[model samples]
Each structure stands twice: as structure tokens, then as C-alpha cells.
Target: MSNPAVSNPAASSRRAARAAVAAPPPRPTSAQASPRPVAALSTRVPLGRRVAKKAFPPAVMLAVASLLVGTSVPANALFDPDAPPASMALSSIADAKVAETVEVEGQVIEAEAASDIATTAASRDAWTVTSYAEMLRLRYGSTNYSYNASGTGPIRWPFPFAAPVTSGFGDRVAPCRGCSSYHRGVDFDAGYGAPVGAIADGIVTAVGRSSSFGYRVEIEHIINGQKVMSLYAHLIDNSSVLTVGAPVVAGEIVGAVGDTGLSTGPHLHLEIHVDSVPVDPFAWLVANAG
Candidate 1:
């Protein structure tokens, strides 16, 4: 029992406990975290962003370009170029009408205009073109063309009759004239009942009575794939015995002469046409007749 020198076990135990609690445990070493997944995420996000940035511009440009290209195409087709031009005679039936220009084609079954007008069907379709460029294209195009300026190839008599030509081609309007209009043909004074022969080889295109020319006959001839039509006016009634589509030789008798179709007297009114344009019969006769 020496009270002054003795230590208390509880207090000593408490103090030991306090000291143990106060001392810190050894810290863990600074081990780094595994970075594989984080690096993958970082690379993936950036690549996706970069690819999106690269693709956007080209796609927009392509869309814009397609819109522009669509608007440039022409709405309607025009006539073709690079083909040779065609010519039409001045005396053509087509030339006599409201047509100052004619369009010739390769496969024309009938002349663009005719002495006998259209009766059964509608009138011929006149091309209503918009511009001169289009008109030129029609003239020069392979399928369409302007009337040939030249006369029908090697003009011979539409009907064989002698010529010192009492009357000529052009307007023959006298006050007393019965036909009383632009004479669509030329008058050749031949004897009544003369045997009228075909000028060239042709088909019997038309045969009938006309108001102006009392008895009329028309022939369609082909030369070098061009159409040449001839009209014989003032023929004797019922003289056109040959039916349509009958072939006749040059200088073959087509009809007999008589005063008809507003003729002042018995004579032959001959018209020479090439691609439907009227031309001077005398010049044609001089150039091509035998």
C-alpha cells in the first residue's frame, strides 16, 4: 500500500486504448485504375463526331446539284439539224394557199395541197410554229423541210399541147373573166378536142368537174423521191376515163380539150407543181420538154 507510487490499471488500459485509436493505419499504395475501357470510350466518341462532320458537306452538295440539273432540260423537242434543206416549186398547190413556206417530207402520200380540196376528212393540219428558229429547223430537218425553191424536176407538159403561149403564168384577171380570181394555173390555147397527153410518168391523182375549170384532171408524179403534181383544167366532161392510181406514161393521152372551168374559150390550163408550189409552166416546158 504505498498509494503515491501505485499506477491504476483501468486508467493505463484506457490510455493505451486511446493511443491505439489515435495512431493511423498504414495508407494503401497509389495503384492506378485500369484505363482500357475509358480510352475506348474517348476514342469512340471522337471518331463518331469526326465521321459525322466529314459526311455532311458532300451530301448537302449532292442534293443541291441534283436540283439544279433537273431544271435545265428542255420542255419540248425541236426539229433536228445536220440534214440538207429542201426546195419547193412556185406553182405548187401548197404555195397557192396561205402557205408562204412549205415543209416537205420523205413519205408524203398526197401533196400538201391539192387542186381537189379535202372533202371527207378535216382540213390539213397547218403547223403553227412559234419562232423563226423553229421554222428554220423545220426547213432543214430530215423529217420536215421548207418548200423546194426549184421547179419540179425537168418540167414537161402536164398535157401535151403546142406552145407559143397566148397567155402566161400569174394572175390573169379581166373584168369579164368567169373564174374571177387568181388564176392558179397557166392557159395554153390549144384546139378544141385535142388529145391531151401526160407530161411525165404519173398516177391519175384526181379526175372531176370543178367550179372554175369545168372539167379537171390531176396527176401525181414522183421524181427522186420528191412529189410533182400537175393539174389539167378545162378538159371535156367525162374525159378522165382512167381511174385513180392508174399509171400513165409521159406523153400519153390523159384527156381531150374542151372549154370548162370558167374558160373564155376552148383551151388548156396547165399547172406544174413540185412539192406543192406553183411554177412557170413555160420555163419548165423549155427546160425539160422533148
Candidate 2:
């Protein structure tokens, strides 16, 4: 044992020299070392793989969703990876259809509206519509299209809009007692009280009532250098205010739709007479009306 106060410089120098020459620490053995943390030695995964779950194709996602919900999925639905969702595809088709319809309608107007607009709705809807591509239907469809277009011609259809024909100009069973089995006029179901118009520039030849026709009106016009007569019957009572021999222009209001004189329902019976012979009113109007 050494005294507490005694200084040992030589001993300290010898101890420092020994420590400097000491052997390096023994390398850690596999068994003696502590095990590494599980997180620190994790297997490397690709960064792209981490984000791939969200990048699955829509079809594949749909199949998986269907399975999760216990719904059967079509086999073809899962195979297509490039196809868009059905809603998106349908929306795109709708947009294309609307665009094409607009273009076709504009072109149709330019082609049909040469001298008058009255001919456009009637002619385009009747004839040229067949020539158009079947897929590109008119935006202003037949039911919605009106015949109110101004006409610079001597003739026009009687109504402001196209009225559906209830009865054709031909032989048919009588609709009511005292009604003629052999039809002489075309019956238009233009709704009750619908305004009737003159088919052409003409003078009122006759206006009266009868047992077969509730209220009748007759007008004579010189069409294409021939005497053409038009008859409107089954008009509402007291609707024909114009007296006999009153001047009327094309599309002049003559009367209103009504059920009278052996009629079953409200409708207009239109007749066309050429050379005192009854002809098909529908055919004559379609051929001659502007």
C-alpha cells in the first residue's frame, strides 16, 4: 500500500504505455452478440410495388369489388385493361350524337329553306329525311317540329303544326250513323278547338251546316291553271264567321276543330276537288302545299 500524499509519476507513465500496446478488442462472435432489431434488417421492396395496389386496371378493380360484394362478374369484363369505364364511354357517345345532330339540322335548314320556311319542315320531314344517315336523327323531331314557318307561295297546310291524320282519304267503315262508308276527305285529329286554316288563296264558295257535316266550308282556288276546290267539314258550330264569297289568303284561319254532323269525335275532315272529282286530300296537300 502507498501513502496517500505520495506522487507516482513513473508508475503512471508505465501504465499509459501498457494500455497503448494492449490487444484490440476481440471481434464479436455470432453467438455471443445480441440479435439485431427486426425492422433494421427488413427485406428491400421496390418503391413502385408499394404504389401498385392503387394502379390496378379499372376492370380488375371492378371484378375485385364485385367479388367482395358477392356479386358475379362477367368474364369479358375483367380481360380488358384499356377500355374506359362504361359511364365515361356512354357520356362520350351522347356528346358526339348531340354535336352531329346540331350540324345536320343546320345543313338541313340551308338545303330546304330556299324560298320559304313552310316547305322546309314539311319537305324535310317527309322526303329528304330518308336520304339522311339513319344514325343522325333530327334534333327537332317530327312531333316537335311546327309548320308555322312563313310561306311566300300561294298554298300552305291548314294547321300551324303538323296534325296527325286520324282517317285517310279512302273507303272505310262508317265511324258513326249516317257517316259515309266511302270516305271523301282526310280526317285530322288536331285537338279540340284547334284553329283551322285555308289551304290556299281562295274565295269562300260555301259556308253552312248539314246533317253529315256539323259546319262546312268550301273554297275555290285557281291552282296551276286548274280549278281546285277545298272543303273543310266537322267544324265547331258558329266558328265559321266568314260569309259566302269572302276572300281568303293561304293559311287564313277558317274555323276550329269540332265534332258535329255524324262525327264520332272532334276532328277536321279535309277534301280536295279537282274538275268536280274528289281526290285524296292528303296527297294533294303534300304535293301542292308550299
By TM-score, the best candidate is: 2
lDDT of 1 by residue, 186-240 (tens): 6666688887777788889888888976888889988658788888888999987
TM-score of each: 0.44, 0.48
Please, what is the whole-model Cα lDDT of each candidate in the order they appear? 0.66, 0.76
Tell how far residue 63 is off in model 2, in angstroms: 86
Task: Report the error of model 1 at residue 73, Å.
Answer: 94
Candidate 2 Cα outliers beyond 4 Å, as residue runs: 1-152
